[model samples]
Target: MAGTTDSGTGEYGGTGGVAPDRAGPAAAPPAGTAANPGPRRSSWRYIGPGIVVAATGVGAGDLVATLIAGSTFGYTLLWAAIIGCVVKISLAEAAGRWHLATGTTLFEGWRSLGHWTTVYFAVYVVVWGFVYGATAMSSSALPLVALFPEGPGLKTWAVITGLVGLVFVWFNRYAVFEKVMTVLIGMKFLIVMYVAIRVAPRLGDAVAGLVPVLPDGSLLYTLGLIGGVGGTITMAAYGYWVNAKGWTDSRWMKVMRLDNRVAYITTGFFVVAMLIIGAELLHSSQIALTSGDRGLIDLGTILEDRFGVVTAKLFLVGFFATSFGALIGVWHGVSLMFADFVDRFIRERFGVDTEDMVEMVASGQRERSFMFRAYLLWLTFPPIGLLFLDEPFGLVVVYGVLGAFFMPFLALTLIWLLNSGRTPAQWRNGLLSNVMLTAAGLLFVVLCAKQVKDLIW
Candidate 1:
């Protein structure tokens, strides 16, 4: 099926918007056209897909989680961070594979699994967004509101941030939005790298940290480290992004492999950077970060006290970018998924109003799905109530446990789906890939168990 043109007419599709072209030269590029794109040209775009995935994968919460691990256990837990990136990379690649091989939205895949799959996500997205939205804004606000004593209270800043992000997401095309995200992702990398450089770990300790050593009685923190590296509900959003990237058909298998590999490599670097900083500077320190998202704010304060106001400010600025990127990423990516889900639901319920029943192609029907922006609004605003309260332990624990479990769920599913005959033979996982992904799933299961225990006990 790869490298062959389909008989059906094609449409020009991208992160932008889609337009059909039944008779024009814009026919779906013959699978071979994509197959034979010069290596140099293909390479440039490959760099891009990875960046988008990596940028979205890292978030403020992941950083804080790494920081806390460092402060408490130092380099002892570095193995978990390394393990984390591997698991996330495997899971994310699998999601991308599903889209490329199946030509189906992940939502559709989940539905096929059972009504329960749909019900789980339906419940999860809303609850997760409600708590996450306010949390994201407050984390972004921490640096600004803290830096400018006269800035609006956290809630006010949060609202402004939400509205501002909403406007950006609502108005911009995908290309423009993705470019903006890439730039912010660079900023995050710069700040994280700078911190790592400053921390300067002992060569011996750093090497030792890479060797897995389960510290006595600290099984919980070990799992936390593995789970925290780059796991999120966002892991499931990879399929939608790949769709935006124009890799929808099986023709793009080779490119997809290169793309997924690059994406997770970047993800791994982002995680390792945090572990380096934590092990070098923060291990065994008395500085305890509060469990809330606000802990990143406390990190900035610590940075400011030790490195000077400018350093603190830099971390804050990075925090804002990281949190806001997560906001916009969720806004743009997850919303796309949610919108598709809603559109599917509507079509299922109302039979797509015959006039509106234009059959949905792999790339069509995206704009009709408003689940994207609606979710952005939900993620940015409702969580504010939690900000005023104590960040209810029940919900936080719920978020942690669910969040921990999601990566493995995504991985194991992909392992099942992709390893099956469903994916193109060329794109299917080899024995080595299966072994690596299986390990990824096992690692997450361990992490999930730790989280469930923490939540229950």
Candidate 2:
């Protein structure tokens, strides 16, 4: 979560935003200083990390959820989708703000919260990444298998996709990773926009959807759409992306905010486009599709019937881009988090002196470290076996429970950190920020409880 006020020292690294040299009287900026380049860098060029987050966070599951909502209720829950994006903007901004304002990574801040934070994260990443690996690879492979039926089948393609993501993230740095994600997300934008236009949504109905309304029996679905839009653990990873963007100080606050806004806004466009497709094509017909990424394949068949083979194929391509972007994004982002978690745990628990770990990590060395690649491998290989079965029932249940609570954990923790003395006064949450965070926290708590209830019952 990112908190920024127009209150700070003058910009130092030729950046447009004010850069506070010192976070507070008590805290110093993390080590590793780069040569300040001439006149403030353009915010336009600094937009890559948000694109990475937006692309990663809005994966196949998000699209499927939006599609299901739109098909079931037309545009009645469109406001929910929009609200989901807004809530996410708050979370991502807070995460980014914590890093820029404090000059410390979010993981380090989590450590300060206590060993429980460390333990929760450690257990979460290992379990979450393991399950997510199979899920992501299988999602990415679905559209491919659909498009090229004669090619590899689902499990084989999943393995291949996992290996491909592993290789891509293991070998590349943030610059290369950011560029690749930009290209893929741009592909998503073009395809989804083209489909939305083809559907030709009614202007009045779409506008009316901006108003909050609850259709009969849509409470659970409404909450799901509102809480699920482009959200995942990647929200927690935003600060690492900010740091990876080489904006460690508050001077980059303006750019970070712009980047964060553009991210959710772009995500909004994607979700809106999919919702339009569903309402126009499926709602009137009252068609039912399976849940999960495979449901997208059913939609493609419908597109083929109504539109043409070309349109259906194009949608499949966009689907591939969405899933694959997430696979690689997690391959990179979460692995970075895991590396930080390991480094911090070792330093604190083992009493190992790793004074330069922060500097080394900030300077991009961590991305290339063995621990980082090990987690990347963990995300790739161990979950491959899950692709064969329906997936172990017990493990899926556990994944669901943990995944449900992550957002609430993030929202409440940010509220605690931002309001506390640990954060500088100027960067702390004000009235609006507190309200938004609190609302977000409550929303997720209800949604999370619902998720657990649904699973158990």
Candidate 3:
């Protein structure tokens, strides 16, 4: 298993409480064994956790954000989407690194950082769960509302979809969950690719988009594009997926890095294709994309006008798949993060070692097996009430501002933790990791300031 001490290092002096060996609850697979045993799949199964992470992170707001950018700034902000992918890749790799290096859940790492982290996360997860629940379900259900001729209102369908997610995540094992997510991700990718290919812009403009340039009157649009590349609370979920994939030990580090890199490369391509569809089909048409998932609705109209109903419907399927992928993702993944948070500090914090700590928590020796499902249900439903009841401007503003706090929290914590001596000498971050995460921290603080300014007087 990963969290265990390196066989080469005699660092523990063997005074240890259950001597550190393979790190977390799920033991790492033997070093030479391929984790996903199947037909001779050429190294792609390693892509599982990363693809799930990507699908979970990108959502209706993200897609809508892209559509609005394409409508307002055309290909001008394509660079930002790609930049966002780079940022997420860094963060995801760090989260995965912490797991492999420390043999602990991310919550364990956060507790080491300070109680403030645990407390901040606890509060953030709850509030974020409530707000995100309604938004995700409603967004997923919107496409259903459109596609079904006599479909119910989005709220009605939202409630039903939320129920479905709750039940789906309730019973499935890790591999089953990953496979279902893969299928949904594939469908969404096809729809986005179809729109982009059918309506590709002039070759000159497409090449020009490869160059970085900000459009006029689009500062806010540019900021959003940079922020919305493809990441979410699920970036934190990377650790859980790492744990679930039997990649918990440090030996899996190389494959984990490759997986994170390839996954976000796929994400960059996905967002860029959406941008091309917008730039080619809607940029000059003077059709504005209003805020929210409705922006994708605007794209569907442009798609329908340009390529007929089939293509438009394909895009709608893409919207549902992307939105609901995020929905189930939060339902399963974030709940693990939240459960780990509550279970780590609240239940087993008797200066417990990571292995015993996690074993106690996972084996129902702790009180919050129910807490995980509580948060999951919180994420999957309850907030459906808010779907019918409009959230006030103050609430939405608060949600936005609260969200601005997480990126900096993640960036700063990773930089400090990895630099600290607690990290094994070999696993300590190199100059590139330090530079990238530090830059991410500073950029996030600036983004936070901008979000605050936008929200305040």
Candidate 4:
């Protein structure tokens, strides 16, 4: 298994069953073995993790954000949406690169940084997961309630969605999860593009919206458009997905970069398509949308009036796919991260060597680990109460505070880890990577400040 050594030589070393703290330099993978299979060419066939990440990251909230930006500012913020995708591409790429280059999980890297990271992550994951579970379930339930208004109440549907996500993630492995997510994302892509075309967006205006411009009172929306497109804590989970996909070393770097770019490009199209719908349909008529996921339901109602019943139902189906995809994606991806966190904690306490653990992560056995299933259940059950009752103000406030800080946390930590001696010299950040990451870090810091301010006042 790959790991660092006490020697300062920046190369993979063999563990030889030594404890993690005293492991030797990593040895190259055995010749002709799966790990050392020389230089596999990057190809479209190696694109599973990116699809999963993209689907997970662009949930209903992101779509609504893009839609609102369109309704509020027409095509004026289109450039920001595209830039947001570019920023996420850098963040995700850095994460994947760190995993491949260092042969250690992102959580392991964070632990090396300090105890503060552990405290922050522990609080963030617990509080954030609790609130996000209900939020995700409710978002998924909205379309189902709209589709079958006579059948079940909102809380009932929310419970059903949460339970369904639990069962799905608990039973399936990453390969099966990736396939299902791809199908759902495909459904979402087609339905969203279909609506965009049906609304007859002005092509010239969309083309012009690519230019950087900020209209009056557009500051927050512009920042939101740039910062919010397809970004979430799930971006930090990209490395775990990359590891889960069995790309555990630097040899897969090219393929990983290709996958990352494809992921964000797909996300960009989703954002742009929604913007077109909002611009041509809602903006043209000066129609307003309700905030949050309900705004999507409102859009479906408007689509029914403007197009037909068939089109409206189709959009709701797409909305469900988008929302549910995110639910399960988090259920799987974040659970993997939590599993790693727990595994590391146990190893440190017991002075266990992590060589086998690294192998387990690479071979996808982490999906079946005890800690993984425990976290999966935690993400599912406890939050159901929030669907039916008002969220506790204190818990909601904590969730907001943590959620606000996470993007900047991810961006800045990545910058620190990648630029430090922890990563192999050859695999460290290049100029372009540094510039993009720095820009992303700064942008998210501003957004984080605004989010904290909103939560406070």
State which candidate, 2 or 3, has the greater lDDT. Answer: 2
As a TM-score, model 2 comes out at 0.93
Query: CA lDDT of each candidate?
Result: 0.66, 0.82, 0.74, 0.84
For each candidate in turn, the TM-score is 0.84, 0.93, 0.89, 0.93
Q: Any runs in candidate 4 off by more than 4 Å, and if so which?
A: 1-32, 35-39, 352-359
Worst 10 residues of 2 by lDDT: 10-19
In terms of lDDT, the poorest run of 10 residues in model 4 is 1-10
Candidate 3 clashes: the total is 11
lDDT of 2 by residue, 185-205 (tens): 999999999988988898799
Could you give the C-alpha RMSD of every candidate to the true structure, in order shown? 5.6, 3.5, 4.5, 4.1
Clashing pairs in 1: 133-379, 335-372
Ranked by TM-score from best down, the candidates are 4, 2, 3, 1
Per-residue lDDT value at 46 in model 1: 55
Error of 4 at 184 (Å): 0.5
By summed lDDT, the worst window of 10 consecutive residues in model 1 runs over 15-24
Clashes of 2: 10
